[model samples]
Target: MLDLPSILNLSGGPVGLFIGSFLASTLLPGGSEAMLVWELQQHPDQAILLCSVATLGNTLGGLSSWLIGWWLGRRYPGRGLSNERQRLALKRVTHYGSPILLLSWLPVIGDPLCLAAGWSGVRLLPATLFIGLGKALRYGALAGAMGSLG
Candidate 1:
């Protein structure tokens, strides 16, 4: 059983990983990959737990961003995307719908894709499901890869 120090030792373990993953999944300017990788290296036995926690945290963060976009869509009915970049993003997601959320794990545009889906009024359940799937797959792959680093 891991304790607080296990979580706090290397800039916080699983808990810290959850928080970092959550923020990184948002539009915020941060990346949890470094911390995640470091933690995985330190605690190889906890890989599944760590990855699951990260995925959950990240999915929640993506949902927060999606909900914000939904709120914006509600708050500003007629006021659509303010700029060309957002417009283009809206176009891409609109072309594919919820399935496009598979790319929500992408680097630069992933968060915006979720935002676009919300702004464009994509269904909530499917979008959230796809987002979670994409994130889980990403974490699974990363952790699987990390398993070989020993």
Candidate 2:
């Protein structure tokens, strides 16, 4: 059966990272951390490049999720937080404001949070800024940790 790792291998290189990061940010289940670490280890000098690409892709993916909510949310009310899991996933988003999007880098709640922000009427500019910054910071920390490994 196909999986995220296999797909990443197929799309290899910086492009793969972009793809992987994008997939990871969407509702789809994925994890770009391994690819980020592997790429950084393979070419430490390209840390900035890899991190930037991944962050950009992930941010765009988050934006896409937001847009989905912005447009379709009204049509399909509660779709963004349909069930108990999503309700729990969106707890922080409901409690906090758009800036809470800074935690958009998180795993389970991350994607739903982005969607909830748009569905809840969070503006696009702030959403993009917070999502991009959060994703970039996560990648930066990952790269830094990998750098210190060897």
Candidate 3:
């Protein structure tokens, strides 16, 4: 039988946990929070490193989704989006600008939000900054919660 505690600890380690969490943040469905918290409990000394890796991994995954969206936008040229929907989404993005990225921390919609931003041809630098900020906030929150519980 697999040792659940050991498995959790390993999965939550700096490299393994980061990769898993990062991939999960993309279109794929997975989550690393439990592993992260478990690792924090098991290895307090590694909390900061774990948190940083998780955040960077997640950000890169989100960026991958954004790149996919950007590429699709170029190839498809908004073919799938209705004019009205495009207009409305565009208006929201334009009005709110980078702040909309804060919502990227949300569950189902968060990944799509990043994708949509790229699809909308949002400025690359601003989009990257906002995504990074949102991802950092998420990791910080998770780390804080884990610290409290630990």
Candidate 4:
């Protein structure tokens, strides 16, 4: 008879919220916005803290994807992308550079964008900055919308 929402709200807490957001920022289809909004509503005083934590967690997740691509590039050596479509994707990422990593906060293609940035050998610091900025903007926007709703 336990309500699922209530159970999640209780078990997740703040740190759990951050972890969920981190995982969601990866290739996973999960989303942390709902949990964040719920936590914000329940603990308005901690809104800023929660937002920062979520952003950091998400940024780290994006960084993980980037690192994975970088590692893969090293592992594969001269194998190249193997297809025209992949070659085009690599070309675009290489042409665009770190700024393209800002799109990493988007849904679906976001995680892949980060990975592409790495595979293209974009500078790590710049890529991280762009990814962090994008995630911060996304979390800020979601928080703003949720605040307005309540």
- Best lDDT among the predictions, by candidate number: 1
lDDT of 2 by residue, 32-92 (tens): 8888887887878888998998999899999988887677667887565676655564576
Pairs in steric clash, model 4: none
Backbone clashes in model 3, listed as residue pairs: none
What is the C-alpha local distance difference test score of each model?
0.84, 0.83, 0.74, 0.80
Q: On residues 1-150, what C-alpha lDDT tens digit does candidate 1 reach at each position? A: 768565575466888888999999898967777777888888888888888888988998888878877889899989878777667778998888888888888898888888888888888899889999999999888887877233
Which runs of model 2 end up more than 4 angstroms from their true locations?
1-10, 77-80, 89-91, 148-150
Q: Report the lDDT of model 1 for residue 40.
A: 85
Count of backbone collisions within predicted model 3: 0
- Candidate 3 lDDT score at position 4: 72
Two-way TM-score contest, 1 vs 3, winner: 1
Comparing candidate 1 with candidate 4, which one achieves the higher lDDT?
1
Question: Against the true structure, candidate 1 has what lDDT?
Answer: 0.84
Per-residue lDDT tens digits for candidate 3, residues 62-143, read 8887787688789999475435544455456667876787776567777777777778787778877888788777777888
Candidate 4 residue spans exceeding 4 A from truth: 1-10, 81-89, 148-150
Best by TM-score: 1
Kindly provide the TM-score of model 1 when superposed on the true structure, using C-alpha atoms: 0.88
